[model samples]
Target: MSRLVKCENGHFYDADKYAKCPNCSRGAGPKKDVVMEGGISTDLDDVKTVAMNIRGNIKSGRSVRIPKVSGRTIKPSNEILDREEQRMRELQEKIRDHKDSLEEQVTLAKESYEIDNDKTVAVHVFENGIEPVVGWLVCVNGEEKGRDYRLIRGRNRIGRDSGMDVTIRKDQKVTREEHCSVVYDEKSNLTFLVPGNGTLTYYKGEMLRQPQQLCSGDAVEIGETKFIFISFCEGERVWKNEEE
Candidate 1:
């Protein structure tokens, strides 16, 4: 689009743009290289330079100067740069911690339960003399209601102690160690309950005085907890004893 130009020197303007001659009254600007623009006689490269000079001189009566945004940007302060680096380092540490946690979970999953990639290390808890479970004592009363304790081939000492074969923690009335004993006789495929030394034990609704046979669904009470025996090594079903 064409535009009009107005100036102190009428010859410096035409119907199209502002053109300045080197000898004009506004000749305080830098020397321009002559270039043909619309057949007007001028040494300025383009009207942009003339407009820049005019805008500069109009503000402070100073010679043409470049605008503030024309040069390199200002550098950030030292504190600002340090703060940004600190934030980046914290974020990197958090990401690294998350990655380490995921790696640990993957390693544990591979060890505990994994697929067909490698030969899995079988759990030898029973092979190491722990014995396969022949029966289970399920709590039907007390704080550990509905919890089951597996009975091994040997005697399973029932107590609140952590080291007991059958650990019952929720019942405080149970002694710390050997409150009672549940023995599984592999020879006869029978389970027997041996009473503790000082603790009171009730089996089948009667206070137990000696070792007595325990059948399935027989209720045994020690402390405040009551358990119903459930046998697995019954008439037709028993674990095969490889050692025998």
Candidate 2:
């Protein structure tokens, strides 16, 4: 078993065997005087010799030692620069091509509208004279008349009256006199639906306030009767008898 004890110098150690503290025995060594080399007399002589040598070397123009560096700055090659420029040019070309394709699509859409109305009307005028029999009206709603109305080069009246060009008896909404009239334009070669006085008439699903030119596949609603306008003079001419 170890026991703790304190020395007179205030150091703690194990005191199981020794009577006096072991830490006090470590300070019993002998002292000796140390002699240093290179006294002031010899040091001054050595410093003077080094100074004289430095002065002689400077006067002789001797080169002094300096640190050397190994790395250098690098630049891109011309071929690499040319390849990057070419890649940029190709990207620009692709952007131009994409823009051109979009413009072409817009142009085609405008052309489609022109062909749907203007060009077709022009061809009809050439084939059937300026005021052409452009289309016909077929009854979609109301009484079965067993007949369709043939549109011609002049004003065609429509009503419940017997004197009208097209008559509908079963539709109570139809007026007795002139309910509506389909008129042909000699200059434009277009057909229009003109609403009569105090009559309810619609062209292309909208109420007709004034004369509206009829296009292919347009619908005309007179009173309760609905008629779809079918154009025959748009693409190719269909031959019909003089009586029709």
Highest-lDDT candidate: 1
Q: What is the lDDT of residue 117 in candidate 1?
A: 24
Give candidate 2 misplaced runs (Cα > 4 Å).
Answer: 1-133, 234-244
Model number with the top TM-score: 1
- Give the per-residue lDDT of model 2 (tens digit) for 76-106: 7889999999999999999999868756654
Clash pairs (backbone) in predicted model 1: none
lDDT of 2: 0.61
Can you write out model 1's per-residue Cα lDDT over 172-228, one digit (the tens) per residue?
Answer: 788888787887766677878876543668999897655778889899998888889
Clashes of each: 0, 0
Task: State how far residue 98 of model 1 sits from its true place (Å).
Answer: 67
Clashing residue pairs, backbone N/CA/C < 3 A, model 2: none
